[model samples]
Target: MTRLTLPSLAALLTLAACDAPADGPVQDPEPAERLATGPLTPAGPAQTVTADADVNLQHAAAVVELDEIQGQGTLTAKLFGTAGGDPAMNGLYVHAAFFLSPAEGWRVFRIGDVLDYRVLSTGPGRVELEIDESVMDPETSEIGSRTRRMILGWAPGAEGAPPETVTVTPAQ
Candidate 1:
């Protein structure tokens, strides 16, 4: 079975960090017209959590914080787990949180209780997260993974309004 060692995983994380936008928000290439959404092609590696862990143990596997344009606020992506029940029930969940103003508070939404997810790319107010689904071989008792992309869009409210919209859709 293939295993992700700490050194290798660290290296991958480092490479991912380098791909993040540094100057400003990168404009999304997709057109504004939303298509008939469905699952996109699976891409990237899977972020897996052992299902043989202790209950009540929580772990933040990955966290990415990006500053949006002046008034757009901040977008944070996290892959975390809180194994409070059965050890076999441990999972890596994906979530996005948007913060505009102190008065507005942070808007949070759960992407999914996926096996894991990777931050594919980020922009001004958008994040592309790849959902990593795990597959198990009954005969071999081995686990494998497949990845599909999803976009988390956080649009700013008009005229500095407190309410903003967050959407999760299959990435093109």
Candidate 2:
């Protein structure tokens, strides 16, 4: 038979003290105060507007705005074949990236890519997209599903003039 040492006996006593009587009633503490009631009221009055107020508002808005590309965009490059053919692939699929203007760099995209804005469909000379600008949930990383349509098209022009004139419009 093993004899309990002083330290071991003290540890056992400590553990026994920690455990509540099994037959005792379990009392749950009262529910916490409902901290979240409804939309919170602003803490103070709105800031005074000044001549530069519009500029300040624009600067704040720009932080969340999507980078807009010019209308003269094109499906300038494509990636095909197996997954290895493109660095942006998720699996075996490959997709095309575009250039809004020849002077602008490429905007890379892959099939079924969902972003703040997404490419809904793509074809030879046109690309359709949906953009959402609603508030997002910080906890779950979810955003409202409301969206607006955007269509991009390439129009061919005569010689000596620009070969392509890109147009961006909302889908009817």
Candidate 3:
């Protein structure tokens, strides 16, 4: 049997609250305003997640239901990431999987090398993520530490299709 500690129970409650559907569409108050700051702690201790992709888990995994975002249905979104690849290709990699209700498995998406990410908005069938990434110097073809915004949207259908991703870079 699994033992539920106070902290784990609290986390479960918080996850439940987040998964709950709102009365209507949810929106971000501001473009830069963050919806949630940190990832929700899973019941168990953080461990390395082995996947088909060659990457190490960077942070604690989070669970969010797509129904809370898109209002489509009860599809669970497992969000996690990796520290990165080699030193030359060091960058945070974000991964998200959608578990379709009544289905036995899930569809995973390896969201490229996002240096950092923020939850911009969620609900109404769409989860917008504002990712801060390092931009390379096009002129010199050298990767620099300069950071910019790369927005990603995950609005998959209940059929478990690929997520709708959009990367937008604001004018500097």
Candidate 4:
């Protein structure tokens, strides 16, 4: 056996620790091979997802379901007190608001106003929301308003779907 110098020994150790070359022929990546198998088979099936991917996908779908509700128009209508309160004002305010007006903003509408409100889900199949009477001095508007949560139905019944109407009255 030949005597080895420190430098030579270090170099030999480095070579021995290097990663090995392909055992034989280069194999196709799992994903690529999966894709080549058949159209019915998913190249990257959810079942085979890494723990991170599974967790992230579960969260991402929930977010998408949540975001779907913003599309409906703004306009809220709810019969809070009594149905016979006023036939004319019976339906939603003629004008509707999809999004809530600023904490204090004014949108004028006739009492008999009818507007399509986006209903929100409160419980399974059932829905509920409170209408807050924004800062509207009674002196400014004809009728004083109050905000109360009104239980309503979500039409076409589906999770995360918008409501048929939402009711908003100026704060009393």
Candidate 5:
């Protein structure tokens, strides 16, 4: 047996430890590329509406009704914007009144008006409204608006009804 010095023993141990296992070639991994630091390129083409597409305005109105009115009211045509050449006639306009209750009195409501009890949504031959109530916060004494949905329909034969004879009912 040969006697080994401390330096030689340490060197041999280092060499043995550094030996790679007999699996495959050892190579350093490629460095990760740095991220670009400027305005980002769009991932895809810009979205656009097709001119030939049959855009259904009725469905859009129904979505707006669900989101806004959620309630309903009967509207009679006291008067409406005349068709043709009138920019205001782009949408339906009607001068109608809402009868909430005998005590509350008959109140006139126009399109887009936020009244004490209701908000009116008017369209060509369509009238809808949402009942609104003011709620008072006990803690901060702040008032907030609360809406209730009413389903509007025509009654079979009710007196003092509109020419269309619509009735308001709480939504199921």
Candidate 6:
């Protein structure tokens, strides 16, 4: 038997990230594609929500949102239930989703009454986002069920997002 060392594993992971589908868009995702087109296998640890932060209350229906980006801003939303109707949301529901297929470009994945997508991943005009698990229904299958691999095909920052700001400090 052969075993891969740490360096080998790291190298493989990095390569996978680069091959990840970014420019792709979800024109009209198919049924089967929904399941397979998941977990890009190259994303950072997504922070989980526990019914706090911005919004809450997961009713029988999901609450979706299309974050309003100003210029180069990042859409950061919160997940978790407050005090609502449906208690079934306690399970592993899609709190949020970030879809972007070769055809779609960069459209955020959301659930609820409406599909409020938010662009996070950036590539020339794209960005990476940690999709929550509040808007997922592995049981539902209605064709346009969800934006599995959706994308944003238009002028960068079409959402009128403002220039983003990030504070960085070097470690000793």
Highest-scoring model, TM-score: 3
| Candidate 5 per-residue C-alpha lDDT over 19-73 given as tens digits, one digit per residue, 9 for 90 to 100 | 8477878765444422334446899999987655556654333221222222334
lDDT of 6 by residue, 147-168 (tens): 3333332233346432132211
Q: Over the stretch 14-86, how does candidate 1's per-residue lDDT look in tens digits?
A: 9999997799877765643334455476799879876756543333323322223232443333333332232
- lDDT by residue (1-172, candidate 3, tens digit) is 9999999999999999997888898775563445345445689888887664534322333321122234435555655666644445436766666664455465656766756666666654445666666667889988766444444455565475544452333423
Looking at model 2, the pairs that clash are 73-100
Question: How well is each residue in 36-130 modelled by candidate 2, as lDDT tens digits?
Answer: 45545799889886566566566344332233333433334432212232222222332334544567654544433222456576665666766
| C-alpha lDDT of residue 32 in model 6 | 81
TM-score for each model: 0.42, 0.27, 0.44, 0.20, 0.23, 0.18
Runs off by more than 4 Å, candidate 6: 1-87, 90-124, 134-172
For candidate 4, what is the total of clashing residue pairs? Answer: 24
Candidate 6: worst-modelled 10 consecutive residues by lDDT: 163-172
- Candidate 5, residue 165: lDDT: 43
Segments of candidate 5 deviating more than 4 angstroms: 1-128, 131-133, 137-141, 156-166
Superposed Cα deviation of residue 127, candidate 3 (Å): 1.8
**How high is the CA lDDT of each candidate model?**
0.58, 0.49, 0.56, 0.40, 0.44, 0.39
The pairs that clash in candidate 1 are none
TM value for model 1: 0.42
Model 2 lDDT, full chain set: 0.49
How many clashes in each structure? 0, 1, 5, 24, 1, 43
Off by over 4 Å in 2: 1-115, 134-146, 156-163
